[model samples]
Target: MAWLLLIVGGMFEVGFTTALRFVDNFRNLPWTLAFFGSVTISMGLLEYAARSIPMGTAYAVWGGIGAVGTVLVGMIFFDEPSTLIRVLLILTIVAAIAGLKLFA
Candidate 1:
């Protein structure tokens, strides 16, 4: 359950970042609200999950999910470059996240 929350938190991390891009330095009210709400939920969930999961492992996984999700969002929605090397590297991060879970 903690792991599930951690994953959800990581997804919210992605949401917050995406919202950030639309905020126009905080001038956009709706997206600014989204950014803050997403951040609040993300942090709350991370804090809760950290109570059970090892801090280092939880943090690494959370960060990995955020990074990978954000990159994919950029690629799929924003037309960011998706070079072969970039994707291969992202897969390694996914593998590392899985490895942490497996060995934890």
Candidate 2:
């Protein structure tokens, strides 16, 4: 359950981060609200996950998900760079997150 929450939090992290781009330095009210709401949810879930998971492991996984998800979202929706190297880096993050879960 905690792991589930952590993953959800990670997804929310992506939401907030992507919304950050739309917020345009926070001049857009709708985007700013989205960003803040997503971030708030993500933090709340992370706090729940911390009850059962080590902070370091949970944080690493959370960050990994956010990073990979944000990159994919940017590539797919925002026309951000998605070079092979960047894709590989995202893959690496996935593998590391999996490794941490397996070894933890």
Candidate 3:
């Protein structure tokens, strides 16, 4: 359950980060609201998960998910570059996240 919460939090981390690009430096009210809302939900879930998961492991997994998800979202929706090296690096992060889960 804690792991599930952590995963959800990580996904919210991705959402908030992606929403940031649409914020237009906080001028866009809707996107700004999305950003704050996601931040609140993400941090809340992360804190809940931290009650059971170790801080270091939870933080690393959360950051990894956000990094990988943001890069994918950028490439698919925002015309960000999707070079081979970039993909490989993202995969590496995924692997590391998996490893942490496995060893945890």
Candidate 4:
């Protein structure tokens, strides 16, 4: 299923970003490799899913997934702020993603 691939790809987007934080400007060999590997799979799946999904919708959804996921990762693992407005905005992104999926 294209949707499955897209969701999984989005998760890989999270993986790549998390790994990126640990890369230390590419000096950390393991994290660097993990970043590249995850990104490769993420993009590959996005590329494939785009064959069926509309390009604009697919790209927007992909970015939304990445943005929301990265922000959550930051707050959870990096002790980033979890202010009310920030969380509300993140929920908006989620709503938008859901809207796109439902309307697509």
Q: Write the per-residue lDDT of candidate 3 for residues 37-85, one digit (tens) a residue.
A: 9999999999999889899999999999989999999999989999999
RMSD for all candidates, in order, please: 0.5, 1.0, 0.8, 0.7
By TM-score, is 1 or 3 better? 1
Tens-digit lDDT track for model 1 on 1-104? 99999999999999999999999989999999999999999999999999999999999999999999999999999999999999999999999999998997
Q: Model 2 — which ten-residue stretch has the worst lDDT?
A: 82-91
User: Which candidate has the top score in TM-score?
Assistant: 1
Error of 4 at 54 (Å): 0.5
Best by lDDT: 1
- Candidate 3 achieves a global lDDT of 0.94
**Residue lDDT tens for model 4, 1-104:** 99889988998999999999999999999999999999999999999999999988888888889889999999998999999999999999999999999999
Score each candidate by Cα lDDT: 0.97, 0.94, 0.94, 0.94
Against the true structure, candidate 2 reaches a TM-score of: 0.94
Model 3 ranges off by over 4 Å? none
Candidate 1 has a TM-score of 0.98
Question: What local lDDT score does residue 78 receive in model 2, on the 0 to 100 scale?
Answer: 84
In terms of lDDT, the poorest run of 10 residues in model 1 is: 55-64
lDDT (Cα) of model 1: 0.97
Which candidate, 1 or 2, would have the higher TM-score against the true structure?
1
